[model samples]
Target: MRHAILITAYTDFFHLIDLTNSFNEDFDIYIHIDKNIYVSPICLKILQSFPRVKSAEQVFHVNWGGRKHVDAILWLCKQALSLSTDAEYFHLISGTDLLVKDLQQFCNFFDKRKGTNFLEYFLLPYQGWESGGLNRLQYKHPLDQLNIKELHDRNVYNRFVNWQITSRRTRPLPNYPIYGGSSWWSLTRDTVNYIYQNYNQNGWYDRLEDTFIPEEMFIQTLLLNSPLKESIVPYNLRYIQWEHKHGSIPAILDEEDIPKILHSCALFARKTDSRISKKLINYFNNNRSSNL
Candidate 1:
C-alpha cells in the first residue's frame, strides 16, 4: 500500500532534504512551505530530485495559534490526495521529524493492520485543561497577521464583534463531543477525505476558524465523533517529547534521546535537528541498515 507524507514546513531546507530523501520514491511527499520562506535554487534542485515530492506554488502564510495553521495542513492534504487516488494513507509530519524505521518496515506494520488508523486522540474536557478546553470552541478572532499594519487594524469594535458574534457557537455542545490531540496523525485516505468534506459541508470549521490552536481540535473532534473512531489505533506512530508543560514547541531531540526513541516503537521522532546531533542520524542509519 502506498503512503503519502504530508508535511508542513517553514525552515531548514537541508533538514528537509534529509527528511525527503530518507523515504523511498514509493511514498510521495506533499509539502506546504511557509509563504515567507524563500527556496534557494540548490534546495529546489534537491527537492526536484525526488520525483514524487510536490510543493505548493501558492504557500500559505501560516500563523501560530490561528486558523492559517489549519489551512496549511488542509492545503497539503488536498495536494497529497490529488497526488494519487490510490494512496492508502497520509501521515501528517513536520520537517523536523525523521523516520526511525525503514519504509519497508513501516509499510509492513501498516499493511498488517490495514483499515486501522494510527491517530491518537482523547475526548476533550480532560484533566489539566483550563475551562475544560471550552474556550478553544467558544472564541473567534480576526486572526491578526504578523505585519504591523495588519495587527494595528484591530479595534475595540472588531474585538467586540469577534467575541460577541463568534462566541455564539452554532455547534451544539455535548451533542458532538469535542476531541483533542497532537497535530501529527496517520489516517486513511477515506478518513482524510471525510474530514475535508465534513469541514466544508458542516459548520464546525467556521466555529473553529477563529479559535486558538484549532488544528489540535477540529480534526480530532470529527474523528472521535465519527464511525471511524472504531478503526483508530490510538497511537500517532511518532515519538515526540513535550518536555515543557504548556510549551508550544517540542524540545529539540538529541543523541541522549535516541535510546528512548528507539524503545518507543514509534516509526518517527520529532524535532530532531541534525545539526544538533549527527550521532542521532548515525544511529538511525546504523539501525535502519541492521533492520534492512
Candidate 2:
C-alpha cells in the first residue's frame, strides 16, 4: 500500500533534513512551506534533492491562536490528497517531527491493521466553563466573546473587534464534553475523501476555522460522528510527553535522549533539532535495519 508523509514548515528547516534522511520508508514525501518565509539556497537544494518530496503550493500564513493553522492544513490536505490517489495512508507531520521507527517496521505495523484511520483521544476540559464548552486552555484566543453575527456580517469594517465582547461576562453555552487530542494524525483515503465530500462541503469550513477553532474538537467530532467511526484505531503512534504546566510544543530531542526514544514503542517523535542529532539518526537506521 502507498504511504505519504505531509510536513508543514514555516521558517526553520533544520529539523526537516533529519526527518527526510532518517525515514527509510519508500513512500512519497510532501511538504507545505509557509509562503511568507523566504527559502534559502540550502533549504531549496535539500527539498529538491528528494525526488519523492513534492511541494504543496497555495500555502497561507498561519497564527498561533488563529484559524490560519486549520486553513493551511485544509489546503495542504487538498494538495496532498490530489497527488496521493493511490496512497493508503497519509501521515500528517510537523516540520519538527522525526521518525522513530524505520520504514519496514512502520510499514509492517500499519499493513497488519485492517482499518486505516489512526488518532488519539483525550477529554477537553471545557464542559464546566460558562462559554458553551469552548475550551480556553486549548485556544488562548477568546473567540466566544466575538459577536458571531456582527463578525460574519462585516466585510472589512469590523476587523478591529476588541473589548466589545468582554470575557468576564461571557459564559459557556453548555455543550457535551468534547474528546480532544493531538492535532496530528494519520488518515485513510476513504475517511479523508468522505470528510472532504460530505461534512466539510458545507459552510462548516469557515465555522471550524474562525469561530471556535479548537484544534482537537473539529476533527474528532466529525470523525466520531461519521459512519466510519468504527474504522478509527484511536491510537496514533507518535509518542510525546507534555507534562509541563505551560507546555505547548514538545521538547527538542538531543543525542542523550536517543536511548529512551528507541524503546518508547512509538513510531515517531517531535521537535528534534537537525544540528545536534546525527547520532540518533544513525542509531535508528542501524537498529531499524537489524530489526528488519
Candidate 3:
C-alpha cells in the first residue's frame, strides 16, 4: 500500500524535516507551510531534501481557530492525491508529530485492514460541551473577524466583533448531523478524494465556511454523513498527554513517556521536539522493527 503523508506545519522547520526522515522511499510526504511565518533558506533546503517531499506552492497564512486551517489541509491533500498515482492511504499529521515505527511496520498494519479508515469522530454536542452544545455550528465566524492581523493587534476590529456585534448568520445550516473530533487522522486515498470533492461540490461547504475551527468538524461531518460512516474509528491514534485542563497544545513528550508510546499501538506520538527529546526519539529510531 503506497502511503501519502500530508502534514500541516507553521514553525520548527528543522524539526519537521527531521520527522520526515523516518519514512523511507515507500512513503510520499506532502507538506503545507503556513504563510504567516517564514522559513529560512537552510531549513527550506532540508525540507526539500527527500525526493518524495512535496511542498504547497500556494500556502495560506493560517489563523489559529480559523477556517484557513481546514483550507491548508485541503490544499496539501489536493497536491498529494494529484501527484502520487499509487496513493492508497493518506495520513494527516501535524508538524509536531513523529512517526514512531518503521515505514514497513505501518504499511503491513494498514495492508491487513485495507478498506477501513482510522479517524477519531464523535457525534457533535455529545454531552461533554458544557457551555455551548450546538452553538458551534450555529455561530458564524466571519473571515475578517478571524483574521490573524485583526485579532493580533486587538484593535477596533476586535471590539467591534465583541459584545457590540449585532450580526447572525444569514445562510442556512446543512442538514447533516455535525461531528467533532481531533483534527488528525489516517484515511484511504479514495476517502480523501471523497472528502475533497464533497466539501468543494456546492452548498454544504458554504454553509459552514465560517464555522468556528471548521477543521475539527468539516472532515468529521463529511465522513459521518457519507457511506463511510461505519468505517470511522472513535479514538485518536496519537499518544498525547493532555496536562492542561483546557489548552490547544498538548504537553511535550518526555523520556518518561517512551514506554507508554512504544506499547500503545499508536503509530505516532506528537508535539515532539527533537531538541528536547533526543533520548526518546533515539530509542524509537534504534528499536524500529527489523522486519522492515
Candidate 4:
C-alpha cells in the first residue's frame, strides 16, 4: 500500500534529508516549511531533487501555541490528499523526527491495521493540562499576532491571559466534546478526507481562530465526536520524552537515549538536534538495512 509522509518543519534541513531518505518508493513525501524562517537555497534545491518529495506551494508563518500551526498541518494534509489520492495512509511528523523502524517494519505494522487511526488523545478536563485544558479554548489567545520568542511579546501575552483569568471572562464551549492530544498522528485516507470535509462544512475553522495550541485539539476533537471515533487507537506511535532536561522540554534525543528509544514501541522519535543527535542519527543510518 502507498503511504504519504506529511511533514511540517522550520529548521534542521540535514535531519529532514535523513528523514526523507529513510523511506522508499512506496511513500510520497510532502513538506510545509514555516515561511517565517529563511531556508538556504541549496537546502531547498536538494530537498526538491528527491524523486518522491514535494514542497508545499502554499506555506504559512507558523507560531507556537497558535492557530496557524493547525492551519499549516491542514494545508499539508490537503496537499498530500490532493496529489496522492491513492495513498492508503498519511503520517504526520516534524522535520527533526527520525524513523525508529525500518521501512518494511513500519509498513507492515500499518498494513495489518488498515483502517485504524493512531494518535495520542484524552478527553477534556484532563489533569495533564492547566485548568483541565478548558482555559485554552475558553479564552481569546492572540498568539498568531505575537512572536512567542520575543520577551516583550511573551510578557504581553502572559498579562493578557492573567487579566482574562482575573476577570473570569470566558467564551462558551463548543456544542460538542473537546479532545486534546499530541499533534502528530497516522491516519487512513478516509479519516483525513472526513476531517477536511467536516472542518470546511462546519464552522470549526473560524471557531478555533484564536484558541491556544489548536493543533493538538483540532483533529482529535473532530474525530472523537464523529462516527470515526471507534477507529482511533490511543497511541500515536512516536517516542517522545517529556522530561525537561538541558533547558528543553520533550528533551532532545541523544546518543545516550538510544536504548530507551529502541525499547519503546514507537515507530519514530522526535525533537532531535543536528548537533546533539549526530550519533543517534548515524546509528539509525548505519543500521537502515536492519529491521530495528
Question: Against the hidden reference, what TM-scores do the models get?
Answer: 0.85, 0.77, 0.87, 0.96
lDDT of 4 at 262: 81
The window of 10 residues in a row where model 4 has the poorest summed lDDT is 54-63
Which consecutive 10 residues in model 3 have the weakest lDDT in total? 156-165
- Please write out the lDDT profile of model 3 over residues 123-242, one tens digit for every residue: 767775533335555655555245645545456435544533356434445666778877889988889989888885446566666566778788888888888888877766777776
- Report the Cα lDDT for residue 126, model 3: 72
Pairs with steric clashes in candidate 2: 130-171, 130-172, 131-171, 131-172, 131-173, 132-172, 132-173
Candidate 2's clash total is 7
Measured by TM-score, how close is model 4 to the native structure?
0.96
Order of the predicted models by TM-score, top scorer first: 4, 3, 1, 2
Cα lDDT of model 4 by residue, 38-58, tens digit: 888888888889998966433
- Predicted model with the maximum lDDT: 4
Number of backbone collisions per candidate: 0, 7, 0, 0
Kindly give the stretch of ten consecutive residues in candidate 1 with the minimal lDDT sum.
Answer: 144-153
Look at candidate 1 and give me any clashing residue pairs: none
Tell me which of candidates 1 and 2 scores higher on TM-score. Answer: 1
Residue pairs with backbone atoms closer than 3 Å in model 3 (clashes): none
For 100-123, candidate 1 gives per-residue lDDT tens digits of: 997788999989987888877787
> Model 2, range 1-292, lDDT digits (tens) per residue?
7887877777557667656666544677777776657778777787768777766343665544455666666666676788877878888888877777767778888788846688886555544333544533322353333333354534232442333244343334224435556778888878767766664533444445443445555566667766887888777777666543223345666667787777787788765555555666566657776776
What lDDT does model 2 reach? 0.64
lDDT rank order? 4, 1, 3, 2
